[model samples]
Target: MKKEFAVIGLGRFGGSICRALAEEGMEVMAIDVDEDRVNEFSMIASHAVVGDTTDESVIKSLGIRNFDHVIVAIGDNIQASILTTLILKELGVNKITVKAQNDYHEKVLRKIGADHVVHPERDMGRRIAHNISSNNVLDYLELSDEHSIVEIVANEKLSGHTLIDLDIRAKYGINIVAIKRRNDIIVSPLAHEEIQTNDILIVIGADVDIVRFEKKVMG
Candidate 1:
């Protein structure tokens, strides 16, 4: 059986999650305080409704606690977001993910029992900055303050060298987990496999190590 998901607050973030879940064939219930927003997703989501999520009665009457996971994506309204999350936690929802506007909001959400809290705007800003700063870097995902996964484009210096020949792990302390060539992807590439220029290397390691590897090898 497909897991059930509930997304409250039909703003850009919530709408995107609902659409993505529906695209993956999951049963998604989209909720919003705005009637127009709810109507927009009526056809895309398994269910769509408009109600104030801050009211515990509204949430319980809608059977929201039964969902496998619930996401609070309320925008701008910090009080509403916090209240909704608190209500969900009290209702014994198994998992509740909340979108926080800032670090202080995230801390409060965590204290109030949000299973996960995301600062999407701040994270996106960092990713954009990284991409623009390094021409060799195609993409960046921050896993922690110290660690990240980056996609780097191979240059002429790495055109013919194999993984073993470069000794990347020993020298740079980073791992090239996969290589993307044109439309194909090579996962856990073998040591003897030679790297081709223009290949996209998906590497993971501490942030400092990844930066060193990108500068030395992909420059």
Candidate 2:
């Protein structure tokens, strides 16, 4: 059965999530205080309503707790965002994900029983910064403060070398989990498999070790 979702606040983050959920054939109820914002999603979401989520009565009337998931994506309004999340929790919403404005906001959301809190803007900024700094780095995913997984574009220096030949694990303490070559993805690649310059290596390891590997091999 398809899951039902209610996304409160019709800003960029919430709107994008709503559309993506709808595209996956899930039922999405889009809500916002602004009538214009609600009207805009009438065709996109299963139900679009102009209602302030801060009000407990409105929350009950909308039956938000019945949805499989609820997302609070209030824009710039920290008070409203926190209030909405608190009300959702009090109403026994199954799962709640909130978009936090900053570290302080994230802390508050966590305390209020938000199942997940996302700092999308901060994460995107880090990703973009990493991509721009290294010519071979295609993307970066931070697993923790000390570890990360990065997509590195295979350079000529790495080409024609098998995993066994490079011994990346022993030398750099990083593991190449997969290799992406255009349409093909080789997961848990064999040690004997040779790398091509066009391949994108998906590697995971300690941040320092990954940087060492990138600089020593990619350059």
Candidate 3:
């Protein structure tokens, strides 16, 4: 069954999400206050409407509660975004995702019952900075303020060493969650599994510990 999704705001982030969802064969309702933006997406989205999302009556009339997921992507206008989210929650929308401009905005959205909040620009900037800073670090994802999941290349020092021989978990407080060699992947790799020179390790642990592991093991 195709899932139903509503994307509010026609800015870069929201527009990209709406297009991708529609391309994936999902039922998408694209909403925005700008008539031009609505016209731009009318051909791609299942439905497109130019309406003020902050108005509860406008939202209810659109039957937004019928959607399985509603993404509040209002840009610049924090008040409109917060009010729309609050109205959606009150109307019993099944799931609500919101894009927050900053930490303060995220806190407010959380307090108002946003199911998920994303800081796309901040998170993307962090990832780009990490990749540029370290050649060994291929990718980095911040799970929380203290924890992260990282993908690093196995170096000569780690090559041919099994998980038990390295004692990575005990020493660095990080777990080798998965091993990726070329196109192959081994999930929850056993202690006896050997690391190849070019293997990619997907490790999960505290941010500090991940840095420690990267320096000691792959530096």
Candidate 4:
């Protein structure tokens, strides 16, 4: 069954998520305090309403707790975000994801029962910086402070070697989870699979080990 989602705040982050969810055929309700913002998404969302989420009665009237998930993407207004999240939790929402403006806001959101908190701008900046800093690193996803999954382009130094020949897990403490070659993706590639130039290696491991592998093996 398709999960139902409610996105409060019709800003960039919330609007993007609402559009994507609708595109995937999921039922999505878009809400915002501004009439214009709600009108803008009227055609895009399954239901678009203008309402102040911070008001408990307004939230209750929308039957928000019935949705599988709720996303609080209120921008700039930290107080409104916190109040809405608290009300959602009090009303027994299954899951709540919130966008935090800063570290303090994230801490508060977690304390108040947010299922997930994201720092989109900060995370995107880090990904862009990682891609720019190393020619080998095509993309990066932070799993935690100490660990990450990175997409690395196989250079000449690594192109001719097989997984077993490289002994990468033993040497670098990282696993090549998948190999993207041309248009194909090999998930959990075999030990005998040989890497080729330009093949994208989706590697997961500790941050330090990944950096070491990038400098030594990818060179």
lDDT winner = 4
| Candidate with the larger lDDT of 3 and 4 | 4
Q: Write the per-residue lDDT of candidate 1 for residues 1-219, one digit (tens) a residue.
A: 999999999899999999999999999999999999999999999999999999999999999999999999999999999999999999999999999999999999999999999988999999999999999998999998799999999999999999999999999999999999999999999999899999999999999999888777766
Overall lDDT per candidate, in order of appearance: 0.95, 0.95, 0.94, 0.96
What TM value does model 1 have? 0.94
Q: Residue pairs in steric clash, candidate 2?
A: none
Instruction: Write down the worst ten-residue block by lDDT for model 1.
Output: 210-219
Candidate 4 per-residue lDDT, tens place, 1-219, comes to 999999999899999999999999999999999999999999999999999999999999999999999999999999999999999999999999999999999999999999999998999998899899998898999987799999999998887899999999999899999999999999999999999999999999999999999998877
lDDT of 3 by residue, 1-219 (tens): 899999999899999999999999999999999999999999999999999989999999999999999999999999999999999999999999999999999999999999999998999999899888888989999898889889999989998899999999999889989999999999999999999998999999998898877777677
Candidate 2 per-residue lDDT over residues 34-140, each given as its tens digit: 99999999999999999989999999999999999999999999999999999999999999999999999999999989999988898899889989999989899
lDDT of 2 at 79: 100
Candidate 3 at residue 46, lDDT?
98
For candidate 2, what is the lDDT? Answer: 0.95
